[model samples]
Structures are given as C-alpha cells and as structure tokens.
Target: MNEEEIVQYFKCQLQEDTNVATAVAAIKTLLEFLKRDTGKDYDKCKKMMSERGELFLKRISMSRNKITTLCCPFIKDGAKILTHAYSKVVLKVLEEAAASKNFSVYVTESQPDLSGKIMAEALRNRNVPVTLILDAAVGYIMEKVDLVIVGAEGVVESGGIINKIGTNQMAVCAKAQNKPFYVVAESFKFVRLFPLNQRDVPDKFKYKADTQQQDLLEEHPWIDYTSPSLITMLFTDLGVLTPSAISDELIKLYL
Candidate 1:
C-alpha cells in the first residue's frame, strides 16, 4: 500500500484492534511518509491529519447518537448512570442528552490516566451533575447506582468486553448488585477474534518499567476484560443488544 492507503488501513485495523499505541505508531509512520513524499509541506500534512481526525470523531459521534436515540426511550428520567474512562462515545451520549436534561451521571476517576476525570469535567461543563468517585469506590457505589454504562476499547465475538482496568470489577459489582451494566461503544471497536477466556488473553498493561514509577505498573493495567454474563446490554452503532446477541451482530459487521 502507498502512504495514504497504509495509514487508512492502519486506522481500520486499529479501530478493530483498539490498540492505541499501534494507532499512534501508524499515524507517525503516515506522517513520515507525508514528509518524504511531499517535502516541506508539514503544515499540509498536519492539516490532513486534523481533518482525518475530525472525520473519525464525527463517525463515532454519529454512532453514539444512534445508540442513544435507540436506548434513551428505555431509560427513565433522572436515572443514575455509572461510567468509567473518557470515551468519545460516552461524551457524545451525554452531550446529546444534555439538552433533554434526562439523566444524572456518576463517573469513576479512572486511575493511571484518570481518563474519567476528563469525562466528568466535560459533563460538568455541559451542566450535567456528575459524581466523581475513586476506582475502589465503584462497588460501594454500585448499590445506589441504577445502571452502569461503560465504553469498550475492544469487544470479541464471544461477547467479552475489553476496557479500562477497573471496568471488570465494576461489572462484577453491578452483577452482584443486580443492576444493569451496559457497554456503550461504536461497532468499529469490536474485534472478530475470540479468546478461550480472560486468562488466555494478552495483558494490555505493559509499560517501560524503569521509565515510570514501579507502583504505577503494580497498581494498574491499561485494560481488563469483563465476562459476557455480567453485562446487561451492549449499545453499539447498530442498536442495543443483549450479550447473547453480540456474536450475531459482530458477524454482520464483517459480512
């Protein structure tokens, strides 16, 4: 593939793989290619990257809008929604629902990156009342929360959820609490491969040991996988699905 074609392929693959580092590397390679092919036009290359980023953002936003429109009718007014991490899909959902003033949200300050802090801040800026809690507090808070709404980094055909490190625990807590734990994600994030189970999957949390604090690596992995039964629904660009429906939905994506 040529420079642009390779970049586009990488985007598509990374969207499926949900590997942020890989995506970044691919983007960097594309930038290098641009510099080589169209010398001294760094500004033009930057502009192209910005525009492409915007287009990807818009696609995800549209997907989130579709899921929200489908699911909102089922959500009661003033429902307490719990979420983790900073996801564009999650942000778009809250943004779209902001005008309706339909629901209140609780977010976890996802450790390490503290991505949820960004989400909470965005919601608060939009005038949405947000309760920010520590990662360990999710279980204690789940009893009071009506529903758990999380975003996925990647999903597999077996209905497994790959997301921020603390999400699996939250899903377990929601299951114990008998509360609905839903995943809000774009269909593009779904991976077609299936693992034997959680143990068989590769750990997503490896970082350079000497570069960062030892405790940081000890405490948090970048992602965790939640079992299918713990999830009540999977909200995607297509529509809302129960765990049993994920395989079928995923198949259609490839077909």
Candidate 2:
C-alpha cells in the first residue's frame, strides 16, 4: 500500500488511528521501490510488491533497532529519564535498556487523554520502574532527569518538531536545566514543511472532553511545535543527528 492507498483506507474506515503516520511512512518506501523498478510486466510487478512488503517490515525492525542502539547508551544504570506522551519507539528503547541496565522512567500524565498513564503502565508491565507525574510537574522534575526523550508527529524542515501538546514546554524545561533533550523518530517522519510557529501546524481532530470545561478547552490544541534551538539531538533511523541536519537529510531523501 502506498500513501494514497493508506490514506484512502483511513477515509473509508471513518475512524481515527494513531498508526496512520507510521503506516504512511512504511508504504512510502514501497512506493519508492516501485518507482525505481518500473515495468509493464505483471510478474515483475508482483515480484517487486513481494520484495517491497518484506523490505517494509525490515525497515520497521531496523528503525526500532536503531532507536534502541542509539538511545540506550544515554540510559545508564540508575538513570532517571523523563518522557512526554507515549511513543512506541520510545517504549521500545526503554524496554531494550531495561533488559541490560536498571533505570527509572518519569511519565507525564498527558492530560485530556492521560496517555502517559498508559505509558507508565506499559513500562511497569515490562518490569521497568516508572513514576507517574502530572503534566504541570515537568519543570519540577527536570532537575532530576538525565535525559528527555520524545516521539515526533512531524519533523519539519526548520528542524522543529510537532508532537503532543506538552512537548514544547518539556523541551523548554530541558533546555533550561541543561539536560539532553532528544527526539527519537524514524527518518520517514521528516517532512519538507517549515513551520515558523505553533500556528503553522494544521489542527488535528479535537478529542471530545467529557468535562464541563469544554468551552475553555477549545483554546488548547492537541499538538504543539518545539523549536529546533531547544532540542539537543535527534535519534533517527539514519543516525544521531543535530536538528539542523534534518533539512539536509530530507533533501537527500526526496530531491
């Protein structure tokens, strides 16, 4: 499946899926492979699709491995790592780290949805020590954290990232405390768009709040942009890179 096909699937299903971005990225690789091996032969096309399917799975595996390999070094035994929201990649890295060294994770209960609680529970299930904190306590806990890791929704050309609404604040807190703030994302999440501010990102579907404060909630957005200047490094499938290098990598991949 290519980007358009995956997109169409979501449209037809009329449901929200968090994996849509990840799916789009995987299918994009398959589409690129088809472009390289263009031909009118049916057998050749079928063979290409078969190979592409395997490659797509391998790509996902590679990305997860790269994330663990690259980020684990930063997670020493007894390290306290803070993360916002829940990212599968981030979870995988934490699990991988736990297999070797002991570390504690601080999860911010990502408000409105409390996805952070889910993350904390998942880590506890994996036998990793976890502590649940309110979203407002990010700055208070920053002094105790060794590193701050997060997943990105979209990594823009400006080297900034679009992620869960509290990400920007987390990044700012990390920067203030001189802690390592890293974004673990696959290269496929890189996009050509350059967002100069938070408003540049299009609005995501508003999750209905069951609370009576819905009127006040309308002013808050689900995602926010973290400026590149605040980020310390990017752990990607390609390698560990500076935020400024994102533009160069994107050009090489697309152009």
Candidate 3:
C-alpha cells in the first residue's frame, strides 16, 4: 500500500476497534512485510503477514497485563474509584485488584456513545460494585472519590492524554479538589503528538471518518486532550511516570 492508503487503513482500523495499540500493531505488521512482499510469492507474503500479526497481538496483551499488574497496588481496599468511558486496560487493573481489594467504582456515562454502561456492566459481572453517573456529575462526585483514573487513546509528547471527551472535565475537577488524577495506558499508546488544545488533536482520532466530509460545528468530537498539569501520574507498561518525565524524555529524543 502507498503511504496514503496505509494511513487511511490505519484510521479505519482504529475507529472500528477503538484501540490505538491494536491499530498500530496492524500497521507495524503490514509495514514490516511490505518490503518482503515485493520479492516473495503471494502465498509466502500472506503467511508472513499472518505470523507477524499474531506476534504483535501477543505483545500487546503481555504489555496490558504488565500495566495491570503495575497499577494494582493503587486500588486500595475500600477505595472509591472514579473512571471514565471504557478502557480495557483500566478494566483489567480493576479486575486484578478486585481479586483482593474491596472497592467501588464510579464511571462517567461518557456522552454521545455512553460507553460507561458497558464498563459498569463488565464490572458488575465480576461482582465489583459500580455506579454509573452522567458526564456532568464528575465534579459532583469528586469529593467522594479517592482518586480519578482513566484510559488514554494517546499519550502525547507534551505528556497530556487524549481520551474520551469527558475525561478533561474529570481531570479539571480532580485538580480543583486536590485529588490525584491518574492515567492507565500501555506504552504503545504513547505517540509523538504535541496537541496545543483539544482542537489540535488529529482529526483521525476525533472523527470516525474523513474530516473534510464533516462539519465540525455540528459534530461531537469523540475525544479531547487533557493537559499534563491536570494529571498526577501515569501507570504505563513501561513504568509509572510523571507527565514531565514523558515531556522531558520524549521531546528530547523525538524532537
């Protein structure tokens, strides 16, 4: 595939799965095999792509497990946790913690899609107490929550996170209340993005299809960027890192 086609394919994959890591894995596999495809027969090239795809999936799963394990300690016994949207990684962390710690979770009814119900249902199945609230209630319940933790679609170079639209509101409330706002994400979700604001986020992430076809004023953005200053820490497969750490390191290396 040419660069433009590959980029379009990646966007479609991401929108379908709602998982950046999986999308990246798919592209990585394709890119790695693209050169090999030029010299190999069709069957051989197909087999190579299949094998690489499986490896990337396994690695993604392993990293998620590692991140879950690393963040387990934060789910203290009887804690009142608040989370937004639906994050598989966040769910895994809570599930692992539920094995021992007794805690209740409050999830935002992330608007436009209302994915929080899915998260709540999943937790209920596991016997974890969960309360689903409207997106606007993030601050109303902030005082009752011990901490705010959410998942990310992307962790940008500025150390800010792009996640479900309501996340920034939750983060702001957390900061105002002096509550720790944490992000649970895999290292692969970290990208070399530098968004100055929510609008600065790439359209591919905010919209499900080609941006030029849509009218922004009438569109509901799928996600928004939360500033690094609002976050207390990030629990990633790589390790627990302060937002500044990501900025200092990613910028120094990538820039």
Candidate 4:
C-alpha cells in the first residue's frame, strides 16, 4: 500500500476502537508490518499481517481479563468505588467482583461525550448499584468513597497517565481525601511519551481527526494528564505495579 493509504487505514482502525490496549496493539502491529522489506511478495505480507492482528486482539482480551480478575479482591463487600469515564476493564472488574461481593459505583458524567452514562447503564444491566454524578461533584463525594479507579489512554515513561479530561482533577481530589487512586490499564497502553504538562500532549491524541475549530481555545480538550504522584498504584496484566516501578517495566518491554 502507498504511504497515504497506510496512514488512512491506521487512522480508521484507531477511530473504530477507543480502547487504548486494542488501538495500540493494532498500531504496533501495523508499524511492525510496515517495517519489513518484503520483496515483491506483498500478498504474503498481507496474509501474515492479518494473522498477527488477530493474535494481538486475543492477547489484549486476555490481558484485560487477567487484570480484572486480579482487581476483584480490591472490591470488598459494600465498598463504594469511584470511577471516571468508561473502561471495559474497570467494568469487567466490577461485574466479576459483584458475583461475590456487593458494591456500588460512582460514575462521573464524563462530558463532551457522556460516556459515563453508558458505563452506568451497563452496570445497571449487570445489577450493580450505579450512581451518576456531575463532573464537578467528584470532590464532594470523594470522602464517601473508599478508592478512585479509572482507565487510561496512555501510561507515559514518567509513570503518569493520560486519560479522559477531568481525570487529573479526580485524581487530585482523591489524593486530598486520602483515598487510593488506582489506574487499570493493559501494558500495551504504555508508550514512550513523556509529556511534561498537559500542553505537551499531542493534539492528534487529544482531539478527533475531523475537528474543524478555527482556534484551539474555543474547544475543550478531550483528555488530560495526571501526574504519577497522585496514583496509589496501577493494576495491569503484568501484575500490580507502583508508579515508580513503571519505568522499569517499560524498559523491559521496549528496550
């Protein structure tokens, strides 16, 4: 395929799935395929790429399941869990834990897209008690919750995380209230990025591709960065990791 066609195909696949694990896996697989100097046998490359893509998808699914199962013990009976945005891994953790321990979940409105409403509805279907809250009320209810858990778009080399907008605010609130702030993400979400601040985050990762605003000041960012210090720990298929230990894991994986 031509360069432009490859770029367009990559964008389409990313847009199709917002799951960080799945999206990054696809991107990595694509990059690996593109790097190969396959001699005129492009058809062989196509078939091999297709097979690898399927395996990556399965690995992502397994990673999520393992992390969720590990997180089950953290959800004690009658505990209240606070979450921001929609995360399939977080949802699975709640649902699986519910079978043995009854608990409640507080979901932020997760604005601009209202993805939290979808999360609330999904939990309700699973018979988990759900409370939908305004984005501004995260602090107001922080003291009432035992812990704060959320998903991430990317886990940077600094051990900080980039997630949906307002995640930073939620993490700050949790720290102030002495509540544990946990991040549940697949190891694949770990990227080589080191965003020093919110502004350092790439715009393509923050905004939709079709955004046509005349000025960036006129639009709200879709994501924000939460510093590593605010996080209590991270739950991943690799095992529960401390924020400080993330760099070591990244080195093992990427170096």
Candidate 5:
C-alpha cells in the first residue's frame, strides 16, 4: 500500500465502522502497513480510491434521502436559516433545496477552529446566500432569523447536545426568542453517557498559554452541551426527531 492506497482503505473502513475509536485504530494500522510497504502500486491504488469515493457518495446519498423525506416538507420558502459549525448534512440539505429559492442562511464564525468560516465559503460557492456573524451576535441575530440549525458532536440518551462551546448559548437565545432550533447530526454521534446534572457535563475549556504581561493563561478548548428542552428538533440520517424521541430511535441502533 502507498499513500493513496492507505487513504482509500481508511475511507472504506470508516464507511463500515460506526465506532469512532475502532475506526481510528484501524486507520492507524493501515498507515503503519503502508509506511512499511515501499512499493507503489498506482493501478491498485487508483481502483481503491474510486471505490472509496463511491462508498462516500453512497453514504451521503443515504443521509440526504432521509433528510429530504423527513425535514424538507417543514421548510418554508424564503425562510431565514441560522446555523453554527460545519456540517456535511446541513450543506447537502441546502444544496438539495437550493432550487426552491426559498431559504437564506446565517452562519456563525465558530471560534478557535473557525469551522463556520469554511462552511460559509462552501455555501457561497454553491450560490447560497449566507450571513456570517460572530458568535456573540447569534442572540441578537436570532430574532431576525426564522430558524436555528446546528451540528452536534455528540448527543446523549437524555437528548442533551454536545457541540461547540458556544452552542449552548445559541440554544438558550433561540429559546428565549421563541424560535425553532434544530440540530442536524448523524445518528453515529449519539453517546450513551448520561450526565446526572449540568455540572456533570465535561469542562471542555483548557488553558493553552500564559502571557507574562497579562498574567493570565489563554485557554482554548472545544465542546459544550445544550439541555434537551432547548432543542426543537433533531435531524439524523434516520429521520427528524424530537428530543424525547431520541432514546427510542437510538434503541433501534442497538438492534
């Protein structure tokens, strides 16, 4: 295996594996194997790459199909959509419905990673009108937006959403504004860990550096959780779900 072959194998394995840790371990092994094999097999590598691409497309198609069936009907023409973070599902939904000429999106410039900037650029390329706002502006802008959509990193059985640090504030604002807030995520992100209280939620914040003049450490970490009630809906590869509906839908995964 060469570089291309190793990448293709990783993609293929990712398509089949739902366990994040296991998938990562498998990719590491594949990379190690490729490093040991110096011989480059261009033809074989190309074939594997093609197959991996096809599998990637298939998985995306599956997710798109589910979202189209479950959520498209609820989208109003010319609605203002608000989203934070970068999500393939959210992008695909916008793309699939672009012809409707029905929606414009507002995206936050998610700090630290600034993933939202990448999403904004992609949406612009697709000719989707996007309003890029700072994280703090979300509440102020929420009143102007008709809907709130966010991507989740992990979802608990109790229906709390673990996402970018600012996400909880966004959800809180959306609730205060009485706006509909939705989470667009894949079912794989759901986690079994149930926090007994808000305090039980992990402290994703960490100190990164210390400035001598300021006498303070600069901490930049990721992730926060929003309580279940703050979310209006959850869109997954399976379907649109309410917070209360999550546990039942998740049980199907075990079967």
Candidate 6:
C-alpha cells in the first residue's frame, strides 16, 4: 500500500489501541516492509505485510521484556521515581519493579490530556505506590526523587526526544538536582529527524486547544523536545545506552 493508505490503516488501529509504543512499532514495521517492495505485486505485498505484522508483534513483546528486565534493576528498594506523561514501556518497567520490590512513583499530570493521571491510576490498580502531581511541580519534587524515568514519543538523530510538553522541564530539573533522567523507548521510536530547537519539532505534535479564553489556547502544546544532554541514559531494547551512543546504533542498523 501507499503511504497514505498505510497511515490510514494504522490510524484506525491507533483509535482501537491506546499504547503509543505498539502503534509506533506497527507503523514502522509496515513502512519498512513496504519500502523493500520493488515490484507492485499485490499478492506478494499482502504476504509480506502479514509477515511483517507478525514480526512487529514479536519485536514489541521482546523490546518491552528487555527494557523491563534491564531497567528494573535501577528501581532499588524504597526507590522514588519521578515520571512525566504516560509511556507503556515505562509503565511496564515500573510494574515489573513493583512485583518484586517496594518502590514509589510520582507522576505529573501531563496536561492537555492529563495522561499522567491515567498512568497514576494504572499503577494504583496494580497496587503499586504512586503519587500524582501537577506538571509545574517537577522541580519541587526533584529533591526527593531518586531517579527520573519517562517515555518517548520519538527519539531524533541528535539523541533528543519528543515527548509530553512538560518532559523538557522535568529533565532540566533532574539535571539541576544531579539526578539520573532516563527514557524508556523501543528502537522503532528512533527517527532521523534532528530537531535543534522547540520550533524545529513537527507542527503535527502541537495541540490545538479550544477554550473560551484565547490566551489559554496559545499556551497549550501537546509535545516538546528534550535535549539529549539532559538525559542520563536511554533504556532501549538494544541495551542501556548513553544518549550519544544512539547515532552509532542507528548507523549500524539503518545506514
């Protein structure tokens, strides 16, 4: 299928699935499979797409497992983790940690959608200790946090991440407090885009808030770029890596 068709197919799937990591993986795998289609052979394309879909599912499962197994070691006894927004991979690691160890999580009410609240409730349902906070309170809670872990929407070539709008500030706070800021993401989330500034990020990520007050609309953004310099490490399926190591991996895999 063409790009538009592929996008629409996944858009429908996204409406049915709330996990960003899964949707992203599915999209990436489908696109990669299509990119290798040299002939417009419909029958062969369907067969290949089906195979790619199965591979995508398996990759997602393994990636989550690898991340949780590797990253849970960081969640020591009585550890306090501060997080922004909701990432399925991040939640999986936290869940795995809580199953065997005692730890607490502080989630920011990532605004526009308050996805952090959703994350907090998910953890509470699992009987894991959790605290909810406002997006602006990250700095206030930084001192008490042993580590900062969040999810990524996309990881650019520069090693920065596009994530919930408040994540950049949260990373900045963690850096200032000498805390480790980590990102939980699958390899598929890495893209070639190298965004230098907030303005360089894709416009599609900007939220259009509809409110009675005009100024309030202008202030709401769905996502923002967090520079790699602020991140302590990235917990990816490939392994735990420094931000600077991302480029080498991308070259080995895709170049």
Best-performing candidate as measured by lDDT: 4
Give the per-residue lDDT of model 4 (tens digit) for 119-197.
Answer: 9999999999999999999989998999988999899989999999999999999989899999999999999998888
Candidate 6 has which clashing residue pairs, if any?
none
lDDT digits (tens) for residues 63-179 of candidate 2 = 989878998998889999999988999999999999999889999999877899999999999999999999999999999999999999888898899888899999999999899
Q: Residues 35-108, candidate 5, lDDT per residue (tens digit)?
A: 67765764578699999999987886787668755666666889899989897777877777776766899999
Q: Which is the better candidate, 4 or 6, if ranked by TM-score?
A: 4
Please give the lDDT score at residue 132 for candidate 2: 98
Whole-model lDDT for model 1 versus the true structure?
0.78
Give the per-residue lDDT digits (tens) of candidate 6, residues 96-200: 999889989999998878898999999999998999998878899999999999999998888889998889999999999999999999999888888988989
Q: Cα RMSDs of all predictions?
A: 7.1, 6.8, 5.5, 5.4, 7.7, 6.9
Quantify all predictions' global Cα lDDT against the true fold. 0.78, 0.85, 0.86, 0.88, 0.78, 0.86
TM agreement with the true structure for every prediction: 0.73, 0.77, 0.82, 0.84, 0.71, 0.80
Better of 1 and 5 by lDDT: 1
Give the residue spans of candidate 3 off by over 4 A: 1-41, 248-255
Q: Residue 106 in candidate 5 has what lDDT?
A: 94
| Cα error, candidate 5, residue 197 (Å) | 5.0
lDDT string for model 1 (89-207, tens) is 77777777767767889999998889889999999998888999999999888888888878888887888788888889999999988998888887888887676555666643323
Lowest lDDT 10-residue stretch of candidate 5: 204-213
Report, for all candidates in order, the number of backbone clashes.
0, 0, 0, 0, 1, 0
Q: In TM-score terms, which candidate is top?
A: 4
Model 4 alpha-carbon miss at residue 203, Å: 2.5
